[model samples]
Target: MAPIKNGRLLFNEVPTGYPIPGRTTVYDGSGTIDVESEPLNGSILVKTLVLSVDPYLRGKMRAPEAKSYNPPFALGEPLYSHGVGKVVRSEHANFKPGDYVYGSLLYAEYFVPKDVSYLQVLVRPEPSLPWSVYIGAAGMPGQTAYYGWKAYSKAKAGETVFVSTAAGPVGSMVVQLAKQDGCKVIASAGSDEKVKFAKEIGADVAFNYKTTNTEEVLAKEGPIDIYWDNVGGSTLDAVLGNVAPFARIIICGYISQYNGEEPYGIKNMRQVLTNRVAINGVLVFDHHARYEEEFYKVVPKKLATGEFKYSEDITRGLDKGGEAILEVQKGTNTAKKVIVVAND
Candidate 1:
């Protein structure tokens, strides 16, 4: 077997604030893998197809000594995240050649995972959507939205719901789900295009948070009964001021604070007390057992039939890996940001 070229995005340095592209994470394209001969040893050899670049990966880019929910990225190894791939070879009985799988895969052209527990065989729908959806709308982000809404939002008909970063994977799903539940959904996005997309997907009202005043929007459309928060900063503080009594707040991500040196301090603590708001943070990994099967059954079918709409911002090739993560971190991405490493 001849050595085929392999490129990987390596965690080069720990960033003090926003990560610098070749300095913080370096793309090394000089490596090679002999696909036919690479040792599997109860592992699966995956020829990476597409990688999911997410905001959460930014939090894991810290120094190894730092303690967090997920471990820090190794200084010189390939960065890993949710991805869809084709199995080239397998030593494990559960997976075999040509199986398309999705899970925590490396940001490289090829990978042989030391652990296979995180990987699962992808369930392709009857009328197929793009494989990227598995990592975007129908994967981790989708499940996060589904489980959080089911477990925490406690939304009822005609209740006003506000979702921050509402054009994003998780936020967009929350908007659509809330609408389907007969809730009046107000969505906020970083750009006008995203705001438009949010409205297109069933938001009763959608606004550009960057240009529109968050406090004013919430004041008009809320007494918010449910708030699905993605960007946790001033927007969250403004939400505190406008929440209905007994409002349920789901803290999905603090994307605004991930790249910052310090966390944003919310000044409206009294609002929480006065409103009797119940705040809970959702980490999707924690609730997968409760929601994974149901999500796969429902969301994928809706997506295929156009009962639900999803937007993905895909950057072609592994070479764009560094820029893809940067797009997600900076909120430059209009929707779910996915890097397509190869065609299936």
Candidate 2:
């Protein structure tokens, strides 16, 4: 068999602020894969299909010594994210050729993993959906929303819930879940188009933070009982000022500070003590063992039935991986940003 060219996105240089395309990451098409003859050792050879472009990756673009939950990207090596791929060859008992899988995958068209401990064979509840959905809606982001809401947000009926970045994968799912639980949902997004999408997905009051006053809207709507803070910074300050007594605050992410020149300091943090708020930081990785099986069983059916709306802003080709992630870091993406390496 002929050797096939492999395309890869390498973490070139670590960035102080927002990562630059050619400077921080580079495309390397110099490698080739001989599918039939390449040594697999004990790893599976996967053909990357879809990769997620998430803001959390920005924290990973730092010095290796900087302590964090995830390891920093090794300079000159392929970047990785929660991705869906097809197993091309396997030397592991758990994987086999033609099996669809989901896990932390490299930013390459083809590669053999050094570790397969975290990989799982994808068994979709609704097999008709696109494989990219597994990386976005029914994958990490959705899992984050489900686990956080169920674990930290003890939202009751008639409570007011505010979700920032409501058009995003996590926030959007939060909006839908809150609405289903009989809460009055208020959602904020960066654009008017996103605001409309939030309303379409069941937000009772959707506002564009860029155009409208967040505090004003929350005041007019009601004191928020549950706040899903995705974009932190000014939004957190605003929500702090507007929360109801004993409000539950889920700190899933702080995307606004991920690439900002200076970190945002909350000015209304005193509201936390005043309202007796319960602030809980939820990391999806922590709850995966407890909730992932249920998430797969539940979310996919709602998504397939059109009862739950999930959107993906896709960029085709592995070469565009750098640009795709930059879109997510800048909050310029309308929905979940996903890079498609190949069609399944």
Candidate 3:
């Protein structure tokens, strides 16, 4: 294929209840994708390989004042999320041509990053793992799990740890990491198939939350010492009811409430006070200053030792991006759902 001097760009015009015409689209554009690109400043042109489709992106699509980790996605602009891309050109000294990097890039074949500071250079070229793994296990979700567990819960050996959305990118890593730390892990997913995959990855106990009563199933498993909460709403409430004395609950992502008209409320806040439990909300970007410090110390070491593992649900093309997003939100994808924008 010849060089893409100009290519199609996909953007979201408005939030929708489901995937529909006005919600997403592809259009043609031209001109240099410099850091000073109009509405998006500090942009850097990138040849995207894999675009990450995450539940968090849905939250970002809400109206501006919704108060998420970042501001809401601008109307009539390309939607952005964590992705792996090749730097085809660079106006920033930290990034150069031919460098394979991972960061927040637009959901397009190419991107001109506004704030390239979020972008990190990918050092491992001949990766023993697939490139998509970096976006899931070794990338953002991996960091989310690692720091959340270490900082908030401090999960230890022999403790009963329960993880919700346990088959997705962050939850899957949390299970393996907890196991590596000698914790007995109980995981909850949307389906029986994902429940099995959760076990295959290291979960001592896995349940299909869609079919089982989370409280009843967890009751048989005994009290949980640590709760890695990826799905909030009823799941969060259930975990609160079953938490052991002095337990730690790490609130990662509320995938359960992301698409809802109103956020889910927990009727069990009193449990935190009664059980002496520590419930902390985690945003990975808040710990950004220590990203390099933590990444080098934790991720690379475990990856080399074969202690960390990850999985992805790959969608074939940009046209399929909307489908991938829907799949993730509906809890259909077993792992990290990634849209392949450009393979080569």
Candidate 4:
């Protein structure tokens, strides 16, 4: 068999703003993997299938020494993050060709993992849910949404929960999950179309935040008992003022502030004090001890019963990864951004 032709996107220069195309990162058009060569007992080579292009990746595109939950993407090296791939060659005892897997892998057509620490064999494949979904709503994002809200919000039946970015992969799932939990849901989106989409997915009331006054809307919606925030700029400020006493605020992501040189300062943080709000910032990795147990026990059941539905905004090639990242950061992608790097 011929060695595989490997193509991958490498982090190039750091971007001070929206990562400029081909400037911050560039796709290495072609390279190779010696499929004919011997492999270590634990090594597995995978052909990339689907990759998730998420906003959090933006924060990671910094100098290698920069501090964060994830180490920075080393310059001129292959970019890596949550993606789904299929094992084509394996020396690993547990993996075999035709097995679909998910992990923190490079955005490459083909590659070998440095170790198995970050990869997991997919127990279930797609068609029931597209294989790409392992990188979308049913994947990391879904787990993040489910765990984040459940862990912090303490949502009870008859209470109301408000979520921002309600049409996004994680936020969209939050709407349905909260409703399924018997919590009344109020959701907000950037556009009118997204507003309707949020409702179609289960938001009790969905509003276009761009045109509406958030403070007024929340006031009319009544005192929100929990805020499942996906964006943490002015909306966080507004919700601060309208929340009920002892309301829970789950900090999921601040997409609104991710690209900003200067953050939108919250004017109502004082409310966090006086309103007795419980604000907790959640990073998915922080809760990995419970990942396998929580994810398999929850998402699979919801998925099987037709109770879970999500959308993906796909970019169709390994080379298009850069464009997909920009689409997500700029809030232009219509749904969850998953890059289709290869056929499953």
Instruction: Give candidate 3 regions above 4 Å deviation.
Output: 1-9, 16-44
Candidate 4 deviant stretches above 4 angstroms: 38-42, 125-127
Clashing pairs in 4: none
Q: How much lDDT does each candidate structure score?
A: 0.91, 0.91, 0.76, 0.84
- Candidate structures ordered by lDDT, highest first: 2, 1, 4, 3
lDDT (tens digit, per residue) of candidate 3 on 13-107: 54555434335544444533432232323445688888778878777766786675567877667777888899776767888888988888776
Candidate with best lDDT: 2
lDDT of 1 by residue, 1-344 (tens): 79999999999999888888898899999999999898888898999998888889998899878789989999999999999999999999999899998889999999999889989998676348988998888888988999999999998999999999999999999999999999999999989999999999999999988788989989888889999999888889999988899999999999888986477789987988898999999999899889888888899999889988999999998777888888888889878999999998
Q: What TM-score does prediction 1 earn?
A: 0.98
lDDT of 2 at 105: 96
Please write out the lDDT profile of model 4 over residues 1-344, one tens digit for every residue. Answer: 67667888999999888987698889887787776573645788888888888889889888767677777888889889898888888888889888888889888888888887799888762347777777777788888887897789888898989999898888998898899889999999888878888999888888988898888889999599999888888889889889899999999898887774588888888988888899999988777686647686668667766778777778998678888888888887888888888886
The residue pairs in collision within model 1 are none
lDDT score, candidate 4, position 301: 64
Error of 1 at 253 (Å): 0.4
Residue-level error in angstroms, candidate 4, position 1 = 3.4
Residue 238 in model 4: shift from native, Å? 0.7
lDDT of 1 at 217: 89
Alpha-carbon deviation at 188 in model 4, angstroms: 1.1
Error of 3 at 104 (Å): 1.4
Each model's total of backbone clashes: 0, 0, 4, 0
Evaluated against the true structure, the overall lDDT of model 2 is 0.91
Candidate order by TM-score, highest to lowest?
A: 2, 1, 4, 3
